[model samples]
Target: MLHLILPSDLDALRELLDENPESLLDVAAVVNCLGTCGLCERRFVPVAPLVESLEPLYGDSKGLHALLRHNQYISLSEAICGFCHADPGLLNMFQKMKKL
Candidate 1:
């Protein structure tokens, strides 16, 4: 299956983050795949609840430890700048909303 972080996916993620900032750790900043990008295509997969786990961080450091070792978390600043700078190949597919 094709897995990519598309513009819509990013937008949805942003909304999700706004609603649930705690999920920050569960998300992966980038995923790459080749296909029609950002058309909201049924074929294009969305990354959400799937990559994110609902479990809270317990005293056990395994989850946080693994995240730190993995080094996959993107800073809030970087996530804000994600609009102009995302996976280049994926950015190429971003369909900017047209003004009416």
Candidate 2:
């Protein structure tokens, strides 16, 4: 569950590496904890999440208007830089989902 690599998930992180192998391990410690950070682990990007932005529908007395917000996407530049710069696989637990 930590390193949930698949055909598509590999595509999403294809560009982010420093041994993003390290980043792979970075995500491992988290998934290991159903008792620790379980049930809420989806926040850590389990699959190559193609999460769409919620276009807010402003309900008014006038009419039910749905406004599509502009420029909601975030750049992965910083995150990529961080993964590339930081320690690679400190836990080094790339093979398993849990530390233990």
> TM-score per candidate, in order?
0.21, 0.20
For model 2, where is the 10-residue window of minimal lDDT?
63-72
User: Which candidate ranks first by lDDT, i.e. highest?
Assistant: 1
Candidate 1 has what TM-score? 0.21
Cα RMSD for candidates in order: 13.9, 18.1
**Cα lDDT of model 2 by residue, 1-100, tens digit:** 4345422343344333212323433432444311112211222222111111111211121211111111112112212222222334522332133444
Question: What is candidate 1's CA lDDT for residue 16?
Answer: 53
Candidate 1 weakest ten by summed lDDT = 71-80
Q: Rate the local accuracy (lDDT) of all candidates.
A: 0.32, 0.25
